[model samples]
Target chain A: MKIGAVIKISGLNKDFPGGVRALRGVSLEVRAGEFLLMLGSSGAGKSTLLRCINGLVAPTSGRVELNGVPVGAGVKNISLREQRKSVGMIFQQFNLVRRLRVLDNVLCGRLYYNPLLSSCFNIFPQRDVQFALSCLERVGLREKAYQRADTLSGGQQQRVGIARALVQQPQVILADEPVASLDPKSARTVMDILREINQQDGITVIASLHDVDLALEYARRVVGVREGAVVVDKAAVKLTPKDIENIYGGAKEQEVYDGTYGRLEYVRA
Target chain B: MSELKRPVLPPTDRDGRRQSGLEKLLYLQRALIIGFVLAVYLWSARGTNLSLPELIEGFPHMADFFSRMLPPNLAILKDLVRPTVETVQIALWGTSLAVLLAIPLGLLAARNIAPHPTLYATARFILNALRSISEMVFALIFVTAVGLGPFPGVLALAFHSAGMLGKFYAEAIENIDPGVVEALEATGAHKLQVIAFGVVPQVLPEFIAYNLYRLEHNVRQATVLGLVGAGGIGFELITSMRLFKYPDTAAILMMILATVTLVDYLSSRLRARVI
Candidate 1:
């Protein structure tokens, strides 16, 4: 891990309407060029933490800093948005505009860099269009550029989502369960792509996942969350059966771990 | 342990019995609602002097008027053409003006897109007030204010249609998938950029659909606006009727019907393409 943290979350807390405390004084650091996986069950606050890092959800208290700039609620509106341009996000649902062409959807990622008037007019410069196309190519969906986003299958749409995020040229990519909605093969393909991006481009990746075996296969660092707090934080290779038990509310960790590892080996073959 | 026996009885309430009292109360409530509806209908009928005998007695007079209106006048068709075209023009201009004015108002009134609650509420109130008054009433007011012409008729239709279109546009805006807007915002898009990309594309087909529908309605209303001397086929119709020119009246009615039918068909086709 690098010495400098790319993203810093210190004592973060988020209380939603109706007094739901989604995050409870959580603090973590993401190093430069690291593949960090956040493991949690549903409602474990992993999604909220990722959103807070990207300024989608403001922390009720504490601070989130991206590239040494404050990005949470207290930051100025313009600067907060400016900081957000450095971070890319992928959702589990692949939230592309269904009615828009895939190319237009990818171009939307560069909206922060373009002038308001030009972007509104949809007059993307040729260079940007080429760049968007190259990003789509990287995701292996170049030929699907002109297709309506909704017409694509679940896996293909998620690849389009990846292309959109990649087009931003962000230093950090935050993915909230990017493969949770896909089949096993597609999920592995997405993970491999994310891993490749992390390795080749050296962009820091923080993804939340429900699948422990996938995390073991891809993540260099793992953070386990249970009920809005980190239960375990360590290197992926160092995580033990006890840590898995702690994260999953004392399920049969040894049996699950062995079963998952066996599947991972078979999948790798 | 022996074959895992299951209950055979039908499910019931907590007391293990169906509640007859509750069922009886529900039935009674439905009966009372029907009775109240019937009573209200009868009361309204009496208040409005809507008697079946009266309608039956008036059929012959209607027949006599229709008989006099026929033996049709094809000669006045050319004279009716100019005013018919003018009525269509009025509708076209009014619909265009309403669309232009309503876009901003509708954005302001949409709850999700409005910058503030106060602005949303105020815009909604203004739209409601505008829609409450009929187009004919607005025509009458504008005619007195701006003097009789197609211009006043256009203004009246524009104002009335703006209220209706604004309400519909706001509803379309409000019904958009919030996730798309969120994704755009997460990309650091400005408010205008969010609206252009996220909101506009999703609601545009509906907006065009509503505008075409309103144009069709406005064309029909434009003819009636001329009744108040606002300049269209209606003015000619009223004049011919007062002078007992039944043939001329019949010709005017035919022209209006043909124009409205053509417009309705074209607008429906356009709407089909849009949706």
Candidate 2:
């Protein structure tokens, strides 16, 4: 809606080949340097929306604009790849090349800038390697840089994921349920790292989260989706229980909305 | 409180039978399969005029021939050494050439990695055509074309093994984890880069293992390729047998066996280490 919005989705709709309507005419704007949390049930189009931003899943109709450039269905492969370079993605599974060393997995983020021959031989420049090591250091995983990525704990693997994204030097990071596979403590640690990245580095972060309390604690802004449409959009502090009720209608009350504000106190204490 | 408790048992049919209709049918089917196999074996034995008495009568002749070829003609071992080394060389060269040709074909034939359906189908068709012809048949053709030598033997092995290795490579590529590929693609890597960083690392060890297996197989095939005059130890065995030099024939056979055994051991060890 704003003139200088970093990511703009307008009337975006994505219908999968099997006729599943994952998104329906969704419109949203993400400001630069904001930590935006998207809340939704399993099939509520949150992941699809994030994928659309990076051109991973092409939208069926309408458009998604990133930094004033159109990126969606019908964009050229070269331009789409260029657009993807500025939009880092972190997955719930921490999808590192499991057999490779942690440093090599993190260096994958710099593949766009490296020459084809160098990337094939895994010969990154010294500066890029140092930068990757620093990103690992920032995530408290500098010691595990030489270890195989699969040998680490779940939280440690996610920290590697963050380090990989950070190596891209991206303007925006899209984390699709980054902590859904972690225990509560590890989830909190990942959220803290993402928040630190957002606040300290001024990187725009759009994270889709399942936990309401975590979203409220870490997000500057929260957008709620129901079925395939946004149902609520508000600043985190101004979010109300009634808005959550509309988003999760007909689901089990206690499981979906019961622990909304209670976990905040637990996290604080 | 004084009464003893009884454990509950599973319910049965009204007739109190343990076997169900499905179980009865399964038993009948198994019995029928066994009977059919027995009948086929008996019919084939009768048709081929197989006689136990004839086999017993032939044992003495086999023993006589073995006795004539006794001691393995160890003095001729040096003469047989060069041919054995040539056979192994043929196998090594053939397998290396096959690997070179198979890599591109396999990349094109793999469904997930192929850029277009037409390319995939064409590559698959070529591979199948290559596989349909036996290695011995190819050896015969190449021997005719090249006028007889280890060159023809090598060519035959390379062409035939390429078909097999290419199919295996395609399967390995298709089976790799898609998430890793997606992660690479999300980082703005090009198509070739995705394949190099994502697909190659996942499949390299398996490709190497398969190549080693093919090398072992090709070594055995190379020994036999010379039977059709493509030039190897088989040529020596055939000549010695034709000339009635039983001792020399025995030496050549032993040499072939030893070479194949060594190749098998080395390939298995390499595969164990790689995988």
Candidate 3:
């Protein structure tokens, strides 16, 4: 395992309290500038794998090396939080502090760098504020920076979440089901923004997705997990309906495979 | 489908008898709770030397005092005004000092802002110690140290109120949304910054309201401390009582009641606006 491979994992195992094994001997490599989609059903260890990479959840056994720094080992372990600052994460819930102004929420990305006095004063250096504004403009929410975060629509809140991550200037962005709470239109918009961030800015994006079409459309590479094991790892162009069926399993009413199923059922109901 | 025969047995246990067991258990539980409450009340009363018969016997004295309070002392109003203003001053100064002292104590006692367990626990212990002593006891001690004056009364109210408000402020800090704190932390702000940005804003309104309440409470306590020679309207009232000038004492009581009502109204309005 050459350290030059960037973010590398080997024999990662995690068993939560009560002996629920979320990940077992999970091993993978995430190269620089790679848009990797960690695909999985509920309880399939995709989130745990992401959490382990950033040190949010420690792996019971195994080594995660990020940028040649050892993670999840003793007191000297690479502080995933410091690493997390460099590598931004977005949640399925958007996770914005609703009472705060959108600009303040976005500026939280710089929390790891600012002093208490500075943050309290909110005297973000003009450059930092400019950067945050530019990030907002990228996500098309520049006008809403002064508004309370809770006032925004679901789509806008998710965009604000993206802007928050962007202000971190992350090398890698891990989005745990980023579009799970959005409508189909909003999901597409968020996915497009992620793809743009990946393509234009050259930031690596690894997002978890349940929608196979979404993963297919946005991700360059999709790694499927089932029961805490990576079952399928392939380029998007190589993925087939058969491979997806293998991922979701064979107990659906047929239309679940099609992208319009979520929309159609609600319309009919 | 032909001829079928049915046999019936005699009713053995009464339905009421079955339910009586449950009813008995409930009654026993209720009696146990009532007995426990009474036992606790009696135990505390005995320790405090608060005897019912003593209180009953004092009713006659209370009647005598009220009779002396008749034919309202309107003439004494001019004399009472000066002492009344002194009482208000004591409360105002006491509340201001408490507010100042409580700011640091409250932050230290707050679970989120304390950062270290030892520091937090120490702050909490100190606050608890301050709050455990009654304000009158505090006044007595401070009066000995500083020499009997409204200064001692003010100090006593400040220390006691700070203890109470510190605990409340800490609890308010604890109840805030952790998500906001985490966000502030993520910004690379120091512990103090997190408290300033994340914890303070959430609890400001509550802190303001609590301070107003403490001010209102201190006014009443200031009157009582005056009886211990802490200097206020109570000092004048106590002199009249000692001199058997019941009409003058009645005048002071009326002033105290009016002052209390006015302070209460103002505090409620302030609290309402804060909310």
Candidate 4:
């Protein structure tokens, strides 16, 4: 009920088309400067949950408050745009516009700040361009600024995604399976960069992950979802093997879940 | 420990829709499409009174025309230069105007960019209406509006070219990655800003290539428009033929064909490098 909580969700219920419920009366809160890992199986609504917070997917019956302002309201209003400006989302696919240069992709985050003609002309202000370069430097890719995004490796492209988010100077970063397509080393590197940004810049990070070990290693808090409900919410340090087993499922339940749908994890057991 | 060999297995249907390597349903669909096309062509030919006997009777006249066309009347080439240049000018001006108008209209027709149902529908309707009428019909209409001149022809070509380019532009816009748009929106970009940054760059090269193709087409079309009193080589050729000056008409036709061919070759080479 505190006024200053960075994110607040109450009585959130989301049902997609065809009557498949992705969230069922879920309620949770996230504080500033917290690195929260959303843990879930393939169909457990990890993506749906992250999307709801930013109005990407509207909940059927729920209230989502970010920085004390409710999402899913009239999009034409200045306030909704303002709220969205502070939240940056990174996708699993490292969805950089492949034809664009790395620096241009990062500078796209300032589209809201510039006039329509300026963006259309692709003319970035000198300071903004310099700031974007620094963000790329933070991801240790300052030298790759001029290269086409498609030319970079998958891991390097994800770093460009991070750099784009950083250039936004967002208050909260939502990463949906940010390292799913990456190799083990790349996954670790991305996680470490996310954690470092959260710690050093005080930028709140809410990342959905299938890897229990990575979640335990980097995230301060872990919220596990099972069948559209938060079954467990605890500090990552306290998340036990028994908790992971429940999250992963027992032999009998695993057979039912695994037969129809595969598990969502960094590595299959 | 007893070692067991895994049983060799044949591949089963992945989605259970397999009927063999060659699908019977696909073959049936193909057959149906071919049948429909043949039936339509046959029916249209019959309805139009397109008789092979009439064509056979006309063969001699065609041969006589070809005989006259030989040697190409190159002696009159000295006087054909000005009209040929006028044709090129008409195409250039018309294409420039169409390219400018199509850039914005195409954006309006794009489903992703034009979120409002009314605007999207209106844009599509306008483009379809423009496309439905041939460029010749557009030339006729413009000639009626502005009186006899290459100016009307230029205007007509511009409008028709806009409609054709607009459709291609809409498709190119629709194919752009939605992620970039989302990223722009998250940065608090207004709708226009989002389109400028996210939509435009993805579709620019395609737009340029399409415009070049339209320009090439306009060159050919402009000559034909002049036949209707709308003022290029076609006008000169038509007048010469009406006056019974067959040699002059032949000279004009030859010049037009040569210019169109050169333009086509140049545009094709340029387009290949754009992508």
**DockQ of the candidate models in sequence:** 0.33, 0.33, 0.20, 0.34
Candidates by TM-score, descending order: 1, 4, 2, 3
Tens-digit per-residue lDDT, B19-94, candidate 1? 6888889989999999999999999988999989989999999999999999779899988889999999999999
TM-score of each: 0.91, 0.87, 0.78, 0.88
Query: Please, what are the lDDT tens digits per residue for candidate 2 over residues B209-268?
Result: 999999999999989888898877888888888888899888888888899999999899
How well is each residue in B1-275 modelled by candidate 3, as lDDT tens digits? 35677876537756436766789999899999999999999999889999789999999999988998886677989888888888989999988998888788888787666756788889999889889988889889999999988899999898988899889988998787764555444433456666666777678889899989998999988888888878789898888889988888788889999999999899999999988
Return the lDDT, model 4, position A204.
Answer: 92
Docking class of 1: acceptable
Residue-by-residue lDDT tens digits, candidate 1, A107-136: 999898899898999989999999999999
Writing each residue's lDDT as its tens digit, candidate 4 over A107-161 gives 9777766767877688989999999999999999999999999999999999999
Tens digits of lDDT, candidate 3, A1-269: 22245688899887765566777788888887888997877667787777677665667798888776776343465454566677777877786777678998788777666665666777788788889999999999999999999999999999998998889888888887899999999999999999999989878888889888788877889999766678788998898888787777665433212221122111111
Model 1's DockQ score: 0.33
**Worst 10-residue stretch by lDDT in candidate 2 chain A?**
A260-269
Lowest-scoring 10 consecutive residues by lDDT in candidate 3 chain B?
A: B181-190
As a whole number from 0 to 100, the lDDT of residue B71 in candidate 2 is: 67
Off by over 4 Å in 2: A1-3, A72-78, A252-269, B1-10, B13-61
For model 4, residues B51-155, the per-residue Cα lDDT tens digits are 999999999998887677665678889788988888889999999998887777888898777766688889999888878888889889989999998998888
